[model samples]
Target: MNKYSYKDLPSRRERLFIALRLPAHIQHSLRLSAELVQGKLDFRKWTDHRDYHITLQFLGDTLVSDIGQLRKTLRSAGAGFQPFELRVSGWGTFGLEEAPKVLWRGIEGELGQLNLLQKRIVEATSSLGYKAELRPYSPHITIAKKFLGQVPGNEDKGIFGVLPEQDLSDNSWLIQDFVLYVTQPGQTPMYEVVDAFSFS
Candidate 1:
């Protein structure tokens, strides 16, 4: 399973990624919480609650031909390890402080264990020819993307000020399994979990 021959794959387009899909109740709670600050910011779109996920490894685009082997590799990667507790908390942005590009909520608890899971996924699958990202993992679930404008200098008047202290410790989940999701590029909330692997 470590190596793959390109010839064995059937060629068809799919953007694939590995992630932990948030449970329905958590997603609902997260959406409600995010709505509070969302009004203070200008975003072109908010991702649907059903689409929320915490990605473990972004596998990027792949042909449908590789999916079968990819699923097997992922299953092997996710074979061991018991479920651990993880919490969703806080909020942040990526890109510039004044004009953010993405708005996302933070994740906490059992981070080292989360990193280990990420590492195993990459190591087990990278040999199949997907380039492993070297960037440090910063796990977050995006609520919205494509910031429309800059935040005012006075942090208190805009999103920075609007954000209140959050503690979603009660909003925690057991990190038990990972899913392989597929989507056609540029489709809205069209993602589908093609396969899943549970930790033993």
Candidate 2:
């Protein structure tokens, strides 16, 4: 007889997702850019540097028992793609201009490959009953959330004009792998990597 048993259920469902982990150098670059506006903008929360990532798909409330099958499917799906290059390009936001919900950094380069890989993952996970979102996929890295600063006007051209452009012209990396991440709601550096799947 073993001390641990599968008969006992896990305490809770995990909030899960698949995403590309950013390289440290790029994270540093994004950090510096955000720091430049930290005093100028008054967002309620800024993303921790360590928690930065570009999400491919969010699997909300995942069952503990489903992880094994998800991992297997992810690995097999991931094996079909080749490594591709990407770079941080610009800035954007989601929600109202006066009070946006998320402030994010944009991505560019090799986007076709990125879209294909995302589509493949969606298809791979669909067999297990994961439904894709109805909205078109728009990839971005969240830098901050819930804008609290005074609203910008036509002359200011919105918050985009306030951000200082970092020298990311030569800053790009090959995305060789993606990871399964679990969200820790109240923790600093909220996301924890559960597994990583490499491309072919």
Candidate 3:
């Protein structure tokens, strides 16, 4: 008999769904742009540039046993899409201007294709028993989080400064594939390519 039983073994890892890699030039531009926003507002904890990505879907956590079928389904879903161009620009917040919680950069152009792809992925994954996100998808790169009780436009003294209205030229990126990522609670997440299916 083995010394270790199932109860004594390490738990399975968490799983996530992620988008394909951004072009090098686009990644550079986004990093530089984020630097420009530093110290300008009460930005939430700045995300590391290495961690920057556009999420196609969030699988939350899943058992390792479920990963193989999830990958096959996602590949089939992604195979229907062709590569498209995406533009990133501007600054914005989620929720009311008086009580914003998420600070994000806007994504424009190729919006329709992105939506279609997202819908397909959701449909494909949902068939595999994953909980589907109920919120209407708004694609944006989250940059920061807002403090509690802080309202935008309140001009409260000595708390944090307002983010200046920025004039951003549209930065474009090409999408070629989608990736599957795994997120671990209480640890830096790990990302591995489950499958890379290209669009036209």
Candidate 1's C-alpha runs over 4 A off are 1-9, 150-156, 167-169, 185-188
Residue by residue across 2-45, what tens digits does model 2's lDDT show? 22332464444778999999999998888888887776677999
Quantify how close model 3 is to the true structure by its C-alpha RMSD in Å. Answer: 5.4
Error of 2 at 140 (Å): 0.5
**Which lDDT tens digits does candidate 1 get at residues 1-200?**
11344455557566788899998888888878777766667788788888999988888878867777888988888887778888888889898866778888889889989989988888888889887787788999998888776346535575666666784546888988999987645766667888889997
Give the C-alpha lDDT of model 2: 0.85
Candidate 1 Cα lDDT to native: 0.80
TM-score of 1: 0.87
- Please, what is the TM-score per model? 0.87, 0.90, 0.77
The numbered model that scores best in lDDT is: 2
**Candidate scoring better on lDDT of 2 and 3:** 2
- Residue 71 lDDT in candidate 1: 86
**Candidate 3 Cα errors over 4 Å, as ranges:** 1-11, 148-170, 184-195
Best-fitting candidate, measured by TM-score?
2
Q: How do the residues 14-39 of candidate 3 rate in per-residue lDDT, one tens digit apiece?
A: 55665755566665666676676554
Model 3 TM-score is: 0.77
Where is model 2 poorest over a 10-residue stretch in terms of lDDT?
Answer: 1-10
Model 1: weakest 10-residue lDDT segment is 1-10
